[model samples]
Target: MTTIKASCPSCGDVELTPHQVRLVVCSVKSWSYYAFICTTCHEEVRKPAGRDVVALLISGGVVAEPWNVPAEVLEEHEGPTLNYDDVLDFALWLEQADLLAAAAAAQGPRPRAQAPETAA
Candidate 1:
């Protein structure tokens, strides 16, 4: 069978079959890329490929590898926007301890003031 020839940046053009090239598709990119170890220099080479190149590579029998991007990228932020004052408040709160106790210490334990008895 006739073998396809590919040129390696590190090494000159070498004879290899289509299956020898590795094609990777990343979800974040509209294009795909390929990596192949040069038979001449034994070094790996990677290059980006457009749709046409991708089709050609697949048609030529290159192995396909797929990768997915993180789902958090699509998630929306519904919480309130933070400002400098808000950040300062949060930092101060973090530095404090026993919030309930601090509140109680500030206000001595005392029964709620009762309304004066109303005369009929």
Candidate 2:
């Protein structure tokens, strides 16, 4: 198997095979990132991949995964801009409600069924 050399923050220089590195390409901003599991420290490492680096990784046979921004996030919003005050207000309000319980509440209560017609 082909080996690719990469630097691990904790372990300095390390060699990883093509199968060890995974490439993540972001379509939104033409950005790419490399993710790998460091062998020496057994830690997950991720770093931005520039154009030249991306080409090198691709040449090494690493799998490339493309990602794009969600459609909902692209939609325009007209809401007021949030500020520190808003965050403080929310924090205060959150304390009043059982936030966790409310979030865990079931979908909603079903409407009561209508009584069958009774002939007098």
Candidate 3:
């Protein structure tokens, strides 16, 4: 597996994992590329759409400063607020719940016990 090292754009920490980063980078843009999702904070280190990156990072606990970064930089990592572990745990819980629901549905409604035939 390939390994890549980079800083968490949200936290300014230089330890983003390869898995945490995505490479859907902007080719023409002169700004830093190499997208990443913070594992500890789940802050999108790239453009996530909706709210600003700083806001999202603040909400997700990715960075300490909510207003330190540039406005444009802050306007990037926007998405649902969630840390990596939270995301994973929630996903697992949802998956288990769905499985249980599916199993219950497949079992269908409970059937009433049939009366035994009387001897003639």
Highest TM-score: which candidate? 2
**Candidate 3, 90: how far from true, in Å?**
44
Q: What stretches of model 1 exceed 4 Å from their correct place?
A: 72-120
- Across 4-78, the per-residue lDDT of candidate 2 in tens digits comes to 999999999999998899998887645679989999999999999987888899999988888887889778989
Better of 1 and 2 by TM-score: 2
Order of quality (lDDT): 2, 1, 3
lDDT score for residue 118 of model 1:
92
Error of 2 at 1 (Å): 2.5
Q: lDDT of all the models against the reference?
A: 0.80, 0.86, 0.54
Q: Work out the TM-score per prediction.
A: 0.53, 0.60, 0.27
Q: Say which candidate scores most in lDDT.
A: 2
**lDDT of model number 3:** 0.54
Q: How many backbone clashes does candidate 2 have?
A: 0
lDDT at position 22, candidate 2: 90
